[model samples]
Target: MATLEDDEADIDPVKMILLDEEGEEKKLTTLDNGAAKPQMQKHYIRSIESTVAIRQLPSEGLSFQLWPAATTLVTLLDGYLSHLSESPLATTLTALSNGGDNGRKLKILELGSGTGLVGIAAAVTLGANVTVTDMPHVIPNLKFNVEANADVVARRGGTVDVAPLRWGEDDDMEVIGREFDLVLASDVVYHDHLYEPLIQTLRFLLNAGARGGEKKVFIMAHLRRWKKDSAFFKKARKLFDVEILHTDPPKEGSRIGVVVYAFVGKN
Candidate 1:
């Protein structure tokens, strides 16, 4: 896992490079908005044969930047949609009928959707209707990225709606609703102070459909950077059955890579 400083180092680049379909690196054209130029990353979704462009406003804050774990989750989603037999997401998503032959498109809700990368990718890959949410202040950037990739998402028969959802806020949670088939997030568990709020949000979502005999799953991709991260998982385990779905190999200069986990309500 990369430390906060290491993640910050990634944002220092002045030129944002995007890959062409042929895999050649090309500089992304900067969009001047009377302020700092937004950093744009183009993630190629092979399943849809299209790319989703995500805009990051680094000047805003950490919530506006792309994170490592988000990229990992996007890759897994691409693999799953490609119907690759070896995709690590097969077991979990198949169980949820996310991209199965269920006839109905999967409905997903994403928490802490920084830059809206994973949510956008999921919509494109699975043709799922995804609601991407974040702090109220972050909603603008999320909407920007979602709109930027709207055509590509529509081509795949998917849609992405942006919303503001503060963690642990019951009113916000109620507004968003718990009718989703699955919940997704990446790089959400970090600050110790946020553990309880995130846990409360998870508890609210995971417990919603239990009485109706409907199983709602929360799949999170996390890169363990601090020893204290264990405390978040420990507390989460008390209410949800948490299980590892996949583990990415460590990236260069990192001791551990991103790990994907599935959390379901305890009976």
Candidate 2:
């Protein structure tokens, strides 16, 4: 099987137009050659008054870079932590917080944790124990971001653990376990070939038994790029109840923005 980097190398340079903090459209190009340099992007968690730094290696592959949807999810998490009742995640997070955990810190698992932005932000914002997982090759970068923000996470009484989790791998899933209160991901639904494996992994996490018999929730932030993306959701709905949690307004020259969805095991 071709590695993620190998697959990335086969594609032509991907041009992505993303919305900046000011909602301005910015163009970014991903090249196959090792021409892009590593850079650190800082995200401020207003709720904690601190910043989480992420390292991006664009030349490595998508797994080593930040995506626009990841930013949207992180922003929502920050707002949710700020006690903003109007936040898109307010209702869902509120229920998870009060769901008989007995005041214990929430345990979260993030899949396809590219750059670890969403997972790291969740750890800092929710004061939860978050495990960020991806392919083995991506663990190093994921750990770097986690360590870069360790102090901030510690200050919030949260912790982050990095692990390798290939979608559809039972052994990987077994090693990670299913004791988490929630699952998270962003920009993980792009590749058409990965759809089945991704959905299989979701089945293992959400449909399988969860801690305390509580149905686990999977929250994913995605930016639709192709019409075929609908197939993944169709397969997912067969095993889980899927709902749209939030939708970001489109940036200039775009028709759709990031959309956050929630998935849970069907009753």
Candidate 3:
């Protein structure tokens, strides 16, 4: 519903995004090469769809065409089904199963929500109000996927919004200026260049400003890349009162690791 993306800035929906076809640079066999530089160009097209069955391109530039690597987007239409563990599906379901007697209707937002799985899972299983966001580059495809599938989300009385959000630099949280019940992000801490900016963004968008929950409440998921991810987490912990909210790395040949994080407040 609210967004702030500079049209001039080029965006790559899949790569920088956690939920789509884009990959972790350390894992990318190409960018890992020392000889390569940040060549400003677009190269590929990958078909990605939302749970509702709307398909769009994840990689929308350059000459390369991409294929979904078992990870893709989900929508409200799928009714919040989760194929993976380590996801909040079970947690949310438990809470919601109580039947809202807790005076708690959750308002949640997910940063870098790839195919909308987590958000969708929360929406369906927990019936939390959710928002899915990503870079301007990925907004088009993200929205298209959401549009294609609205059925799943509609059933649980869950509402999902797709917005444009960038990890680094200027952010527009004002348009979305209200406080949230739960904030989440997945696979967003792998970039060194984005380190500080990501922290700043979190502080800006979260942190209850001496009011709300006495701090911000957030849960983040990432596949651990020791050096890069640990460094970021260590520094981030210094900024917020943090706890190892959760962790469930893939066993073997699972292709990815999964960890959950919860931040209480800012330092």
Candidate 4:
């Protein structure tokens, strides 16, 4: 088992390039409409063993900001790609399912994609086609980040698509119906109200794979915030075979521990 230290990465420091100066005229222009100025934060993701450069922002809401779990998952995924054939689950997650030799690309779907780091990592590192989704308000930022790294992903023989998906919505589920070989999520199970809805979404995605006779997998990295929020994991266990792939407290930043889990439908 590889420790988090083995896969640790960093976020680069923000540059001092300024877009505009804050002056009395700027304040007056904004105060005329009584609307608050937009605040956008820039971020750079630094990987230990990957060449991809990822930048993201909080375009709409708290849901659109980059989270620590995203960095952890991408680092872990980058590490896992080095030893793919060692684990059956990893092989299934990344291998081609055309009934021939393995070591081919995969189709991935990322739930609650937020700033699109993990999805981009899947595309750039694993050479997988990834669809990154989130709520409608967050789609703009998600698309921005995905497009920001378009060349890097393409250079690695992968592609990225951004979409809006609200969990437990039939229409949203239809937009992503049965198409992905793997599903990825990070830091999504925080709210207790989302427990059943998240489970329903997972069930829908896993059953899609079953209908196609392909063994699909859902991989998630969650940093537990409250004991009661474990309901999502508890609910997931009833529908899928849930296995913890990795667990480690954040080596830097806040002390939230990330636990990666692989889930497959029950037989």
Candidate 5:
């Protein structure tokens, strides 16, 4: 007993049908909260993937002031796994990328870790001990996210430590005693004004070098912009033997720029 109005409504279709990861057909939500959150908040996730190797980032307002960020994060970790010959970390460490040798249990440090995605991914992927550090204001979310990723750590057989570190602070470094086998930073160079202090922190955390004394490998992922300074790369090079290991364009015809820096600590 359908009326003309009912037929018209059916034809119009209030919502489009969509499929979930499991391929269940469902109506697309008109009010999609998953797109992005505006509030500065934090939420937990018990799981992320079945890889048995990946950390889950807390979903709520996790201070991601950086853009092209979530995807870029995936890229950084992906690069870490694939940049076999490109990465400048300890030879033994890089050798483990293929999971051929999971013997490496490195002490890693991540600075300016917005939500600990890059560091968490590394810890999960490499089974390394990761120390994720950011400013005090950013620590709570970082800690929450790390906890959210507990399953990932447990499955991957690695540990992630969250801590607070301020840029350009000497006393802080003296207290923390930057001792790490690998150093990572992602999307941290957006603020040209804060570059020097950020670089200083990197210097403190990095291991000696591939020469095998104190320093170790350091990797930084960034989005290149037309307005960015050419000297930025030069400055990093002057401080350490910096090299370009990988560059990935925006994903799937998307408009985003990304590049990773592989630095060999100078003796």
Candidate 6:
């Protein structure tokens, strides 16, 4: 895992180019962590659809810092998933919202859950059983943040768990047995070196649906930082059916662009 410094403004990303089948070339956008302070700090995220306040403890490593892609996903979940609207994700949301007394909770696994913002929002607002995972070094603060909001999540009939997952490790994969309806990741493609391991993890989780299990869906919210970042998407398109659900410019006039994608097994 790479460590990011307190200030990333001067860190120019590795330049790369991407071309489509038609030979059309497009510039890749640079990623910005966005106002992330590398210090022990607490953050408050308010739900747009409800009065739930998600508490976050961002401490220690770069993985603990809050990122904009997490915020975008949280906002999307808070604003859109709250209602029982007619969308591709509606069935999953319905299962989550109705899980409490029905004894059938919609299980969710969040990979690279920095600060656990999006997962916490899902637990507290949607009452889904969410397992938030990240690197081992970042698990302490991640667990602390989860415990700090345990009561809020429990009160809403949801539960939060934390695990240490280092992408392509066999032990980590053994620990994270495949049994989730939805898999989530936000802004995890910043480092080009991690593309293979990250995609491997996704493949493992997505393949859990084989063997007569329920269909699984993967949703990722990404902030494109450079043209090379598209490499991950290109690699992923070969493994799963990918769809762009939403797109928006980075907040506060950042040069990067944000897009949310939903993926399902091709079979």
Please provide, for model 6 over 116-200, each residue's C-alpha lDDT reduced to its tens digit, 9 standing for 90 to 100: 8788887776678999999887887788788877777888788999998999888899899898778888888888899999988
**Ranking, TM-score, top scorer first:** 2, 1, 6, 4, 5, 3
Q: Itemize residue pairs with steric clashes in candidate 4.
A: none
How much does each candidate deviate from the true structure in C-alpha RMSD?
A: 5.3, 6.1, 11.0, 8.6, 13.1, 9.9
TM-score of 1: 0.84
Which 10-residue window in model 1 sums to the lowest lDDT?
8-17
lDDT of 1 by residue, 72-160 (tens): 88888888877874754677787777343448888899999988999999898888999999999899888889999988889889999
Sorting all predicted structures by lDDT, with the top scorer first, yields 2, 1, 6, 4, 5, 3
Model 3 Cα lDDT, one tens digit per residue, 95-115? 334433455666777776655
lDDT of 2 by residue, 66-86 (tens): 788999998899888787647
TM-score of each prediction = 0.84, 0.89, 0.62, 0.74, 0.67, 0.75
What's model 5's lDDT at 4?
20
Q: All candidates' lDDT scores?
A: 0.79, 0.82, 0.51, 0.68, 0.58, 0.69
Model 2 lDDT-worst window of ten: 3-12
List, residue by residue over 43-130, the lDDT tens digit for candidate 5: 1222333332222222432344333433344444554555433444334355433332256477778888876766777777667788
C-alpha RMSD between model 1 and the true structure: 5.3
Candidate of highest lDDT: 2
Tens digit per residue, CA lDDT, model 4, 1-267: 943323334222221111112211112123345543444433232432445444333234447556667767776666666663344445555454453236556778999987787898888777778999988988877777777778788888999998888899999898788777788999797667888888889889988653248667888887665556555666777889988777765544434466778898987
Candidate 5 residue-wise lDDT at 95: 47
Q: Which ten residues in a row have the lowest lDDT in candidate 4?
A: 15-24
Steric collisions counted per model: 0, 0, 21, 0, 7, 5
- Pairs that collide, model 1: none
